[model samples]
Target: MEVNRFESINEGTILLIDKPYGWTSFDVVGKLRSLIKKYTGDKSTKIGHAGTLDPLATGLLVICTGKATKRVVDLTADSKEYIAKIKLGETTPSFDLETKIDATYPFDHVNRELVETVLKTFTGSQMQEPPAFSAKYVNGKRAYEYARKGVDPKLEPVPIEIQSIELVGFDLPSLVIKILCSKGTYIRALARDIGKALNTGAHLVELRRTRSGVFSIEQALSIAEVEKKLSNMCNQS
Candidate 1:
C-alpha cells in the first residue's frame, strides 16, 4: 500500500498559493510549472490556476497539477470574499488606480450613515459591467484594446449578486469594505456604482481576496516555501 501511494503521488496535487499583488495568474502558473519540472524532473506535470487575479489585487491563488487541473472549474465557480478599500470623490478609466483619472470632486459630504445606505442598495442581483481594462473578450480582442483606442465597446451587462457588503472602516474619501459575493462579481463596478449613488464618485483604492469557495488565504503557500520543501525532500533522498 505504501508503494502504491508513492507511485500515485504524481497523479495530482492541489497547492494553495498566496499570490502577491501585481502578478498575473498565468505568471504564477508559468513559475510553478517551471518549479515543478525542475524539482520532480517531470516535464509533463501539467499546471494551471483556478482563477484570474488582477495585478492590483492579491490573495489566495489555487494551483492544480496533473489530474487536479480538471477540478479548476468547480473551484472557480465557488463564491469569493474580499477585503477592499474604495475611494470616494474620484473616478478612473480602469475603475481602479491603474487607469487614468477621469474625474475628482469633493466628498466631504459623504458620511458613514450614507455609506451604509448605499451598501444596502448594492445588495441583491443586478447587472454589472466589467472594467474596460479587464480580460473580458470583445470581438476577438480584449476590452482594454477598445478602451485604449478611445472606442467604448458596447459591452453587455452581466448579472451578479452581492451577498453582503459592509463598511469596516472610513477615513474621509477612503473607505474599507468587506464583500461576500457570488461568482463573476466585479468589485470595481460595485465601487463605481457606490460612488455614483453617494454623489461623490469612487474607485477601488485597494483590494485583496481573503477567501474563495472553501479555500482561504491562510492555507496558501509562497513560492519560496514550496521550493524549500522540494529541496529538503531531494536532500533526504
Candidate 2:
C-alpha cells in the first residue's frame, strides 16, 4: 500500500480494532494518536472512539478518526452484543471477577435447567441499578470512588432492554451466555441479578464484545497489525 493513498482515506472514517485485555479505552486512543502521528506526521487530524469497554473485557472497539469524532454521540447509542462467562456461587463487590469476593454459596442447587429458566427472567425491558463500582455519577462523584472506600451509595435504577439472552454453555458453577441488548445494559448487574434469582450468587468471570452494531470481531484489526500498517507507510516515504 502506498503512503500517499492514505491522503485519500479522508476524515470521518470508521475503523474497528480488537482491543487487547487490560487496556483502557483511553489507552487505546492514546496509542492510536501516537501511531497516527508517527505515520502521517499530521497533528491536526482528530481521533475518537465510541463506547467504553472495561479493561478486563476485550473485543471490538470502534474507532473514529478526523471528522468521525462528530458522530460518536450517535454511534455510542448503537446496540452491542457480548459473549460472557458468569461464575456462580460467588458474589463480588464490583459484580465482576475484578472485585473481592464478599461471599460464596453452595451451587449444588443450580443446574443447566435452572440456568435456562433464569435466562427467561432477564429478557425484555426492565429497570436495572448500576453497580456501586461503576463509572456512573453519584452525588457528582464517580460511583466506583465511593465504592472503593467504605461507603455504599444509593445507585438508582435505569431502563434497559435485553433483546435476547441465550445460554451458550454451562460447567457446574460457571455459565457461558450470549446477550444482545440496547445501550446502557450492564452484564455485571445481570450476573448479580441472575444469581439472586437462582438463590445463588454470580459474577462475570470473562467477557468479550462480539459485536457492536455493524462492527464485529471479524472486521477488527489488532493493535500490532495497525502499528505495522503505519510503519509500512513511514518506510515507503
Highest lDDT: give the candidate number.
2
Over 1-237, each residue of candidate 2 has an lDDT whose tens digit, in order, gives 111124432354777889999999889989988878778786777878888898889998988877777878888898999999999999999999778899998889898898899899898999999999889998899999999996897899999999999999889788999999998988899999999999998999899999988778887888998888778877887
lDDT at residue 69 of model 1 (Cα atoms) = 79
After superposition, the stretches of candidate 1 with alpha carbons farther than 4 Å from their true spots are 1-9
User: Candidate 2 overall Cα lDDT vs. reference?
Assistant: 0.86
lDDT of each: 0.82, 0.86
Per the 3 Å backbone cut-off, how many clashing residue pairs does candidate 1 have? Answer: 0
* Candidate 2 TM-score versus the reference: 0.94
Candidate number of the best TM-score = 2
Q: Assess candidate 1 and give its lDDT.
A: 0.82
